[model samples]
Target: MNIHEYQAQKILKTFGIKVPYSILASNLEETVYAAKKVFKKTKNYICVIKAQIHAGGRGKGGGIKIAKSIDDVYKKSSNILGRRLVTNQTNKKGKLVNKVIISEYVLNSDKEYYVSIFYDRNIYKNIILYSKEGGLEIEDISKKIYFQKIDPYIGLQEFQIRKIAFHLKMKYSAFNNFIKKLYNAYIYSDASLFEINPFLITNDNEILAIDAKVRLDDNAFFRNLSYKEMSDEREYSIIELEAKKAGLNFLKLDGNVACMVNGAGLAMATMDMIKIYGANPANFLDLGGKADSKRIKKGLDLILKDKKVKLILINIFGGIVRCDIVAEGIIKFFEKKNKINLPIIIRLEGTNVNIAKKILNNSKLHYYYVTSLEEAANKIKVLLKNELRCFI
Candidate 1:
């Protein structure tokens, strides 16, 4: 799960990594007080007011501002707090900023660098991605990045540290210590990604993480209970939160077709088939191995919540989950709702397929049923084409 920058900085500090003195605030008065606290603690007049959100590119989205005085801090914090911050990583609607971090502003840094550690799926090992050029334009200069892979079992090596330090022309002693501590922090935290952009070397020769972005592996949360508190439910939509509670995997998207499938791989294939047939998927919903009546009803309710959804596609390959159970759930849902405005397309195979088909055929609900993937694809193409024709 992704966390705010302030929380990431706090985690870094726990690992003996140096970061700018910062205070978290939720309002104008608190922001002003936090700025005073930072200035006094750091003995610096200038402080930075940064909006706390899960996405990056906050600086370009007017979420980061310089505060030279108490009044400046108040004004800047007022503007950021409660504002919807739109960044490249976020949607057009943007994310709401309920908190801001007021930090000591470092001026005239000797150098700015980008460093990140993440698991490389291709090689099945963790790798360090670093670059001499850092900042907001890192995306444009990605070709300049250097990748160094670390052995999962052996951990980071001394030679790898020296190679990166030499490439960046950094002092060996300081760089070595900083990298080791950072790597340890990443491993200890069970972080999927630990990034420090604009890693600063102050004029006083101190290494500091100016900006931090951390994402922890959700699967590893059992070992790190403290990290669970860092989760912000405000970052997720109500539907997504509900899905999580119901033991389902659901992600909302911007399209017209809502998909409900049994497995992750099949869900992906369903989405691809939708796109290939000249339609877009509205959401990714995985019903898991147990597609019971309650789960099916919950998934359908979640799908209907999105007003953008124009069609519902239920594709289930019943291995452990019975297809008849799924059919019963769909019929029961429509019975309670009395009416469904959107069209439903269902394709069920394996495990009581005949029984499931018989059940669905007897239900009097208006739905298109297909027997094969190829038939489903054709049905989707015709239905979506007809939908567009009606819209036009």
Candidate 2:
């Protein structure tokens, strides 16, 4: 989950990482109060007011502003608060900026650095990325010559740390201390990504994390409250929560065809195929393995409630979920709902396949059953085309 810089900084503090003191404000008055409260000693102290949104590129979006004076701080916060900040990652309408985090800004030269640790599921390793050139062009700099390694079980070992430090041309004494501390922080926080863009070097030649951005793994939420609290209300819609509560994974998309699949990979491929067939998928719904009749019923109910859903598609490549079990689930859902009017296309290929066809054929619901994925897509396209014509 993406969090505000303030929240990420708080996590850093817990790991003994030095960070600036800050306060959060959601309004103009609060912004002024925060500016007054946080930066008391230094009149000419540099301050940054950043919009507390889930997405990134805040600087480019005008969500991040630097103020030279208290009045400037208040002015910048006023302009940012209650405004819609658009980033490359945000939707066209942009995300609403309701809160701003004001913090003391640090000063350093442009010769910054970048470091990050990520879990690559495919390689099944903890990968650490580092670059001497930090800030805006870090990614571009990475392409030139950077360092990355994949360790099976352990994270950045001492030798690996030394290698990165040496490769980045960091001073031996400082790099050793920085590498050890940073590596420990990466492990302790269970972060998927820990990045310090422009990991600054002060005039005293001391390394400081001027800007922090960390993304923790959601699967680790049971242990990480800091990441959980950073969640934004606008990030999840009502339909999404409903699906989650029902033990289904759902992502709402701009499409008319609603999909219900058994696995994540299957769901993604289904969405891709639907798009290829000139049909849009309204949702990515994964019922998961071992889903029973009740769960299936819940999934169907959730999809049917979406007014934009003109066609429903159930594609299950069952292994743990037998075809008969799925058939029973669909039957139970229709019975409970007392009616089924939407055009549904079903494609089941796995255990008890013939039995599933038998059960579906006996049902009174208006639906089509296809063995081939292409046939299902074609049928859904035709159904949606008819729906458009009827609407017109």
Candidate 3:
């Protein structure tokens, strides 16, 4: 779960970290008003209007603007709000910018740095990575990075914090306090990543986090109700949001084959099989154990929304869910929806398999029923290859 920079900054403030105060604005008038208010408080007319999308490279995308005057704020906000923001990471079509963060701009930082702490899954340990070199080129930045591995089981040790701060050449007293609070907040929030990019040191020797990029662990949402509420639907695709609301596990991928399976383990195995068969999976849609016609139809409908999906593979190994019952759900969906165009390959094993076969056979749809995994795989490869035409 990704949160906007403003949202992350607000959380940082609660942890006793120093951050430039900001107001969330969604329009031109609000932006103007926010600029005026911030200027009044800071006694400085200059402020920054930043786009509130989840992705980075905002500066290059014209998503980050420095407003020198109230007019500048209005003009920049007018151009940004409700416009599509294209960055290095975002698709060329871009993500729509629905809001902006009008914040008091910090001027003339003596130095800028990047610092992040997160669990390193490869080694199963928490790591803190800091670098003086901060920019778009990750490879270059990584080469100059100084890192420290923290024991997740024991948490961040006091000596380890001092060691990192010293390595970064931070001699100030306040920076130490800031690091402690930052570490505390990161652990308590169940954050997957807590990044402070361009964490600057002002001439006055004060530590300030100039940017916040935070991602909280979804599995830990049970302990973070407020964090869950901070979810911005704008960051997600319509189909993705819909799937989540429908209480189904789904993720869109880059492929032509749309897979709908019963269990997560089975869904993964199905995708792996598809790959082995020399075809990529378009999406992962796990229907779970108990699925009715409504749920099945909804899943199918969502999968069909992706135009790249040329085939639908329904793999079900029945135990609690009878094959015949699932087959009924499948038939019910196709009977109502249009575009009975794509070939559907179904491999149903276990209870009532014969009955399920009979139902599908009687449906008179362009369906392929394979009793063996190898047969299903071979059929998928042939159909996928045929549908994919040559340059001619």
Candidate 4:
């Protein structure tokens, strides 16, 4: 649902927002060509080369650089293109940089500010937050700021834009246009979150959105086919992509205990219990309230694909989904694969629980069943301790 900065800039342009003149290029020669074109138009020898990746904090990880000359553009692009970019939001392993955005670099920016519009789930309203202190994380956002909660039914207004601009001490001529353009882009783009970090104010009284980050709502994917094509599979892991294709919600974490649960609520509780028991979850895979044999097999396969998983924990309190059906799927999956030594723990309750326990009891696979959440935690604690012994 997230897109690279160049794509975000395209969306901004569609709404008449001003951004730096730029070109997207995937290779060294293309990068130089893009810079040359920008220099010709803007007559600015200084160009910026940015690594195109989904995650932010790119500047902190050297994914962004300023090229003062054409030679600098080629050199920086070559070093960045094929490298794996690591940022604070991304894992230590980083992501592959397949392309770079070359743009005209602006100079003599008098001030920087942070501006973002996002839905505040706590209050279920869209919130617009901005601060003169730019290039800082949310935690570091300055107390001198503006937080406006707008009703989507009313849309944006001229006064709202003027207020923000006035507070930032922006020039009257440019602020009105900049604010209207950016707000309209957010409204029309079906964006879940839109942010412009370091929205630059140049000495020449021009406003420029220096960096943009946009995330689209997944539920609205059907409405925007163009946005779908902009999605990069390289943003996800192989297992993550496969899990998504299988209609499962999966996230890989830096832990060893693999969690399998029937609902998002239970999945969260299971992960919390794991932490309470002094263990970390390797992944979060929600099977939902419904599961068939194929889904069960796919879930198990996905769990096993994670090499960090030292123990598999299944927690099911069936409501719409029958526990017996889930148990049968689990047994048959292990039976077909003949996986007898894998460590699996289960806690089942509600909806044909008796039959489900019986099915699991008769299976040849090594599955430990518990009666309560506390017992499940204890079991995981014991198993993980023994697992640690093997490596130690």
RMSD of each: 2.6, 3.4, 4.0, 3.0
lDDT of 2 at 63: 89
- Relative to the true structure, candidate 3 reaches a TM of 0.84
Which 10 consecutive positions of candidate 1 have the poorest summed lDDT? 383-392
For candidate 1, write residues 177-210 as lDDT tens digits: 8999999999999999999998978666768899
Question: Which 10 consecutive residues of model 3 have the lowest summed lDDT?
Answer: 133-142
Estimate, for each residue in 1-392, the C-alpha lDDT of model 4 and write its tens digit: 89999999999988887788989998899999999998998987888899999899888899999897889888888889999999998899999999899988877455788889988877877888988778746446557778888788887777787787788777667787777777778877889899998788766666789899999976677887788888888888999899988889898899988988888888999999999989999999999867767788999899888777788888888788888998999888887774434578888899999999888888776678898888988988998788732210
TM-score of each: 0.92, 0.85, 0.84, 0.90
lDDT of each: 0.89, 0.78, 0.85, 0.85
* Candidate 2 CA-lDDT value: 0.78
| Candidate with the greatest TM-score versus the true structure | 1
Can you give the lDDT of residue 196 in candidate 2? 74
Per-residue accuracy of model 2 over 1-392 as CA lDDT, tens digit each: 66667778787777766666678897898888888877784454578898888777788889888887789987788889998899977878788888888887776576778777667788777777788887766655647456567574665576776788788888766676666676677777777777777686666666777678877777787886656777665656778877766768887777888899999999988998899999999998999996678888888878877888888899998798898899888877776665445777889998898998898888765568887888888887888777732110
How does model 1 score by TM-score? 0.92
Candidate 3 — what's its lDDT? 0.85
